[model samples]
Structures are given as structure tokens and as C-alpha cells.
Target: MTVALVTGATQGLGLALVEGLAQRLDPTDTVYLTGRDMNRVMTAVESMPGGGAEVRGELLDVADHQAAQRLAQQIRERHGGIDIVFGNAVMRVGPDDDPRVIADQYTEVNNFGTTRLLRAFAPLLRDNGRLLVVASSLGTLHHLAPVLHDRFTTPSSLDEIDEQIARWRDELKDRRTGAWPAFVNIPSKIGQVAAVRVLAAERREDDLHRGILIASVCPGMINTPTSALWWNVSTAPTPAQAAVALLDLALDPVKPEHHGELVRFGEVVPFS
Candidate 1:
């Protein structure tokens, strides 16, 4: 029986991803959807169409390290290991938001949250499993200043990424943020992609030999409440439409070349 998990799946693209997975996975397969609140998680699961895969809900605040670790252990014990994981939780900061607050929320939820998920769940990926992180095209290294590229791309450990995020947060708090991109999401997304790259490289041999694939993906611009918070979504694809590409990457045959890369519409996007 295939077991899959999607974090922050109460609504928007995450909800769409869960729905798509339910429809595609076999009836015996299980899909777990998570959100910060139990009510919202259960509500989302109840609202999904029935007679697909078995859909369940759980409370998961991706920013909580211990929470992620506990859930990972629970899944490992209950199902032996998971077949797929979609790291869909993220925080988006608006232009009007305070820089200091953005620094904290974005780094905690978007950057370090990704790290926590990777730490907790990556090791439990069964053979032929897949782990796909929801990043964005804006996450490209080119979006960051030239001086920061090497630091992001060549991180020796996940802790290095965490340290870099902490340094950026400190700079924002100290009002010494000249080196960072004007928008906090840029660096936040870059950090997420960087974490995925670091993990993929660190596990390259094992992943290849075991037929596992890990990747970061950009779903392109999508019309969702979160996008409405920051951009014009009138012309953007709907969440269900954007989900097609993400679900494709999650369910399609594992591609070794796509491992450790940022993908969009099934194509590898240059990190630089």
C-alpha cells in the first residue's frame, strides 16, 4: 500500500495537491493531509471527494521541529516508511509587511521549516520513494546577489543553511539588510531550494542506488489566497491547474537528472 503525506494541505495549492493525489493513487493507497489546526485538517479531508484513495488528516505546524520529528516517527512506525512526501507548507510576506516580522516568519516557516521536514522525513523515504519540495521560479540563484551564490550552493550541511538564515534575520532586525534581496521571499525561497540541493547531493549515491528521487519544484504563478496576498492572481492558473505539474513530478517515473534540481512543468530549471 502506497502511503503519502502533504504538509500544510488545508487549502490553496496544498489542498489541490491532496485532491489530485487522492484521485490518482489507488483505492488502497493512503494520503495524509496536514495543517496547523485539527479542525481545518479534518474539514479539508471531509470536503474531499470520496471513493478515491483513503484520505486522513493530522495537525502539523511545519515550523515546529519536535512536531515534525514526532509525525515522522509515527508514520515510520505505522507504515514502515512513506512512499512520497510533498513539502508544501510555506509563508508569503507582503510588500506592506514589516521587514523585521517578515524576517522571522519567512525564515521560520519557509526556510527552516523546509529543513525540519527534510531532517524528519527524508531518512524514512522507502526505496523508489519521492520527496518534492514546493519552491518557486523566483528561487533561482540569479535572484540573489553574486556574493551570496557560493554560500547557498555549496553549503556543507543543513546547519549551514540555518546559520545563513539566522544571519539574514539578524541583519534585518539590526536594519543592516543591504546585502539581501529587497523582498524577503526571494531569499526565503532560495534557502528552501538550497536546502533541497544540499540534501540531494549528500544522499546522491544512496538515492540513486535505492531508486529514490528528491527535488524542488516551482508550480508557476497560481491563483490562491496566498498569491492574492502578494500578487495579481486574476490571470494566474487556478490551484487545481497549477497542481497538475506538481502532481506529475510527484507521481511520474523517477528521473535521476531531476534529482537535486529545481523543476517546473517537468523540466529542470537552472539554479543559477
Candidate 2:
């Protein structure tokens, strides 16, 4: 039986994917639908239709490296190996108005926390297992160039972004100026690209054990709680819609051929 583990599954895209996966997973497969909220996550799981895959809600804060590691061990103990893992939790780190603090917070979770998830569970991902990083079109730099130069920078490594953060902290002694925290938030394109690049780089070898496929997906500007403000102003896809795209990668029969590709909707969107 193939089991699945998803972090940040309480609501928005996470919950949407869990709901979709619940319907898609076989009856024997187990799924760890997780998020930071215990009650809310449990409620979302129970409320969703067809808990066929041993649906269970786990209160997980992936930002906590120890907790993420422990969770992986628990999954390993319970299922022996995982068939699929969606490392998809991300957040802006601090108060939006305060860019310096905001940059710090975004860098911590969106970048470091994501790596933590991969580090904890990469070993247990079964051979031929697929790993999907729910990245953002916002993270697609080349697409948002020329017009978005003022708002977004070219893609770079999380380490690069972190270095900038460190520099911003030193330069901006005053948190009131605002852009200090914002500068550390790596452009969305960088976040999406870096996730796949880092994942593949970390696990390039070991093809013999089982072919693990990693892809950075730009799910487009989906209408989630975080992007609700864009609801009326911009055309946004639903989480359910985005879930469909993600499911394609998660359940693909041929992974190695598609690994490390940046995909959007149903197409293989190219990137640096």
C-alpha cells in the first residue's frame, strides 16, 4: 500500500490537496494530513469526504527541525516507507508592515523550514516515490521580469537570500523603515526554483535503491486565504484546481523522465 505524507495540510492549498488525495488514494494507503493547528486540522480531515486512506490529522510545525525529524521517524515506523511527500508549507515570517522582521520570518519558514522537511523525510521516500514541492508562479522569476523588477528580484539560493537577510539586518538598524525585512524574502521565483534544485542536488545519486523524482511546481496564482485579496482584482485558480495539477505529478507513472522539471497546470514550464 502506498502511503502519503503532507505538511501544512490544515487549510488553503494544503487542505485542498488533502481532500483531493483522500479521494485519490487507495483504501489501504495511509495519509498524514498535517498542519500547525491540532483541532482545526483534525476537523478539516474529518470533514473532508472519503477518509479511505487512513486519514489522520497531525499538528505539525515544520519550522521546528526536531519536530519534523521526529515526525519522519514516526512515519517510517508506521509505514516503513512513504510513497509520496508534499513539502508545501510556507509563510512570510513577520509583520507585513515591518519588512525587516517580515523578511526574517519568511526566510526562516519558506526557505529553512522547507529544507528541514526534505532533510527529515528524504531517506524514507520509497524508490520511485515522487516528491512535489508546491511552489508559486510568484516564484517564477523569468515570467515576472521587466514589469516586476521593482517588486521582485531575480531568483537565487536560499543561502544567498539568507546572506542578504544578514546584510539587511546589519544595515537597517531601524525596523521602522520597512523594506529591511522585505528584502530578505527571496523572490517567489527563487523559492520555487531553489526547492527543486536543492532537493535534486541533495539526492542526485542513489538511483539504484529507488528513483526519487523531485519537481518544483508553479501552481499559478491560486485563490487561497493568503491570496484572497486578489480574489476580485485578479483571475486566480481555486485550490481544488491547483490540486488537480499537483495530483498529476504526485501520481505520475513515469517520474524520472519528469524529475526536476518546473511544471505549471499541465505543462512543463521551463525555468533556470
On TM-score, the candidate that comes out on top is: 1
Residue ranges of candidate 1 with Cα displaced over 4 Å: none
TM-score, cand. 2 = 0.80
Worst 10 residues of 1 by lDDT: 92-101
Q: Per-residue alpha-carbon lDDT of model 2 for 199-236, expressed as tens digits?
A: 56556666424677777777777765556533451567
Residue 97 error, candidate 2, Å = 3.2
The TM-score, computed over Cα atoms with residue i paired to residue i, of candidate 1 is 0.97
Clashing pairs for model 1 are: none
Per-residue CA lDDT of model 1 for 152-204, tens digit only, reads 87677899989988888899888998778878878888888989998999999
How high is the lDDT of residue 160 in model 1? Answer: 94
- Count of residue pairs whose backbone atoms collide, per candidate: 0, 10
User: How big is the positional error of residue 193 in model 1, measured in Å on the Cα after superposition?
Assistant: 0.4
- TM-score to native of every candidate shown: 0.97, 0.80
